[model samples]
Every structure is written in structure tokens, then in C-alpha cells.
Target: MEASTSERPAAAEGGVAPMVRFDRVTKRYGALTVLDDLQLDIAAGEKVAIIGPSGSGKTTVLRMLMTLERIDGGVIWVDGEPMTHMPGPGAAGSGSLVPASQRHLRQVRGKVGMVFQHFNLFPHMSALKNCMEAPVTVLGLSRKEARERGAELLSMVGLGDKLDHFPGQLSGGQQQRVAIARALAMRPKVMLFDEVTSALDPELVGEVLTVIRKLGAEHDLTMIMVTHQMGFAKEFADRVCFFYQGRIAETGAPAELFGNPENERTRQFLSAVLEAG
Candidate 1:
């Protein structure tokens, strides 16, 4: 059920390999199958927007990539390496893969960074300290180096003056910006935004999206976003994927898909969303 425009070539025949690949990945919770054999590829530096109704498994995609949820079936590859499994007794490219060790998972997962809907900043730490913790501990960066990197990212997100403010002291949108800066401090190759603006006040959404727009323009990072912001997606994404029943029912350039959707479900969904809005 993978879908894409003719302009976007299939992953196997592409000029460069995909930065991330969900190879027949599946996820289940008890009798509920959340993601069913989902196969997708994202090239390096691509901006992909995933849109679907609730319970269609959009957020699960990011969670799986972040290793917050394990798959029931298939391999998830990141940066040409398997994140869910490791090569078994052979060379890295062509060989059997067994379930990955914790060390292997940690190594591969380091390439991805995710920002969830809610601003999960620590209330006790200043915005600067929140951005600096991971680099200092996980990446083994010295306090001096982490501080510099953290400050740079915070400033990039337009929070230079609020670095010393704790989460409770800042607005919701401001806190989310810090979360983005914190994620960027790790220098991830892939960035995932799961309904990042969903929890923001209506007027505040623009500020966060503005920062994201700047990020896409300035960074080489691949960005994957699952969002309901149709206007933003239409303006910002390189590709739009419409998920239905846990699979992509339609995908194409923003103008092509939004203006002339081929799938009935896609058209109906868009109509409902537009009407509701």
C-alpha cells in the first residue's frame, strides 16, 4: 500500500539509498494491529508529511523509529543500518539479521530525534539545561561543549533570552521550541515531529512552524512530520502521504495530492477536514 508520485522514484532504484526504511514493519497491541506491514522509504534531507485520521497509526511510526515501541515483524533501517536488528555472523550489508542488542539499538537510534505533541520539558530545569543534559550524558560531550551547542540551538529557535527560564516560566510554544532545540543538540540525521502544534494555542502555532520552516531551509536533516496542519503541510512539505487503515492510500507533491487526490478515501478525508475547519 505504499504510494508516491512518479517524480519520487522507488527506493530500490534511487540514486542514493534511503536514510530511513520501514521494511514490512508491523506493530500490534494485543489483538489490535496498529501498523500493518508498513513499507516506506525517506531519502536523506527529504521533507515528508504524514496525514491521517486518528487511530490510523501515524504517531506510531515515529515511536517505532524512536525505539519507544518495538515491532512485531520486520526490520527498520536507519542511515543504511538496521535499528531493530543486527547483522548476524556476516558482513554488514548482505547477511541474516537477528534481534538487535541494546547497544546496537542505542547506536542506530542515535541518528533520529523526535518532538512529541506535548511539551515534555522538565519543569525544574532551565530551557538551557534541558537542551544540554543529553549531549553531556549520552553523547559524552563536556559541559563546556554541550553548553555552547545547547545555547546555539536555543538561539537558533529564537529563545536566546529565555535560556534561563524554566518550562513553567515559559509559554507552551516557547517550551516546545526548547524541546526542538534539545533534540537538535544531539545532531540527529532524521527529525520527527508528531503533532507538534496540536497542543499549542491557536495563535502560538505559527511561531513553532516558523522555526521549523527555518530549520528545513537551513539544515540538511531529513524531516518526517505527522500533522493535521493542512496549510502548513501544503506550504512546507516536499511530499504528502495520506494514510488510511494503517497504510498509505495516496501520496504525491502537495499541490497534486491536495488539489487532485486520486483515492476516494483521501478525497473524503480532505473534504471532511476542510469542512470541519
Candidate 2:
């Protein structure tokens, strides 16, 4: 089913605009449509959890927002500016969306950071070095400044003692925590977590979740996470979006959606996921 603007929260209420907005966004892979005219809004400092069955386009949302994937249609607005398109003439962020230049993409992408399912760390770099690399190279921070920032973040994620440890030397949970710290080192306004714990051993999941929970509690970031950890989502997210067939089947506050889902698909999904656990 096609999602209408009516289904989404107002893009801007009062004078405040959303930190992120997907305006009639669409994505396709060959003949298969992955996201069908999706409309969604996320306010600053809000934590949103996207949950759905495999192939329902949950991960696609994060990947696209992080610009790892491109949309076939529509604009993606981030920090009140177009991330997927170039802002038109005159005032910044004005007029119609147009295809963005690579320079435009790189400029806008700096405001968002993503942690993937697999810890895509540099095999040869130490945890702290991995965190320091981008800040020094991309953001042009002094190596000393980047190193200090990286060490602080690693400490925040409970890896202060493992600064010198390579990804191979770290446990799966430890590696994922380092990944989270590395993302934070970028100082992004928006953070994307794509099933960050999915690659961890079952016993390792809690430690990664603990670091994430700590970051959420203390940070003012706009976080969008694709996760299967229902209990954590129910507890952590300000809003829960249940996706089905490439559109949002249902969305609401955690208590409302998880406790009393109105959509049949959402209800069935939650029931099955809960039962499976």
C-alpha cells in the first residue's frame, strides 16, 4: 500500500523543522521496490526504532539515510537541508530538490554517522587509531586533537584500557563498542545503528547494548536504529515504526505500539518475534 503524507507527522510543526524527513522517498532494486514512497519525520534528539521482518526494508532506511544506498525518488532532508538533493537557488535549503553533486553529498554526509551490523573496522589499526583516522583525515583535525577525542570516546564506550588493541585482539562485543565510539568521534548530529548487535555472540549483545544505552542517555544525538532487540527498543525508543512491505505498517510510542498495536501486521510481527524469543 502507498503511504500518504497524512500518515506522517507534520514535517515542521510551529517554527521547528524535523532533524530528518523522508519526503515521498522511494528505492528500487531492478524490478523489486524496496521502499515505496515512504514519508517519515524525526525530531532532533529523538531516538527511533525501525522493526520489521527480514526484507521488509528496515535496514534500507538506515543505509539510505547514511547514503550507502541512494533513493530512486524523492528528497531526504537532514538538519533542515537536503541530503539527497541540492538545495535550489537563492536562500539555502530553498526551492525544489535536484540531483546532488558528489561535493554536495560529501558536505551533507558529515552530519550523519553510521555503525553497521558487521564491525567494519580497519584490521590493522588499533581501536583508538580507527576512531582517530576519520577526524584527522576527513575533518582535518590535528592528529593530537583527533587522538585525544578518540581516546575520550573509547573510554566512554568502556574501552579506555584497550586503546592499543587491534580489532582482532578485541572480543566481538568490544569490537562493536569500538565501532560505536568510532562513529561518535565524528560528532554527528544524527547516528544510525544498523543491527549493531546482530553480529555479536549472544553473550556479547548485552555489553554492546549497555554502551548504546549509555550513549543515548547522555547524548543529544538524533538516533535511528534498525534492531531486533524488542525489549531494548521498547525501553529506549521514543517512537517505534513497524514496517511491512516497504511501507510503515504502524508507528507510535513504544508503549502504544508494542503494548497495543493497532495494525494487524504489527500485532502479528510482534507476536511472532516475542514467541520466537
Compared with the true structure, what per-residue lDDT tens digits does model 2 show for residues 1-277? 1212122224565656688999889999999999998989899999999999999999999999999998888778888777877755553433544577789999999999999899899999999999999999999999999999999999999999999999999999999999999999999999999999999889999999998899889989999999999999999999999999999999999999999999999989999999999
How far off is residue 187 in model 2, in Å?
0.5
The global C-alpha lDDT for each of the candidates, from Candidate 1 onward, is: 0.89, 0.89
RMSD of 2: 3.4
lDDT at 197 for candidate 2?
A: 92
Candidate 1 at 268: error in angstroms?
Answer: 0.8
lDDT of 1 by residue, 84-144 (tens): 8777665444556778889998999899999989978878899999999999999999999
RMSD for each model, in Å, please?
Answer: 4.3, 3.4
Error of 2 at 21 (Å): 0.4
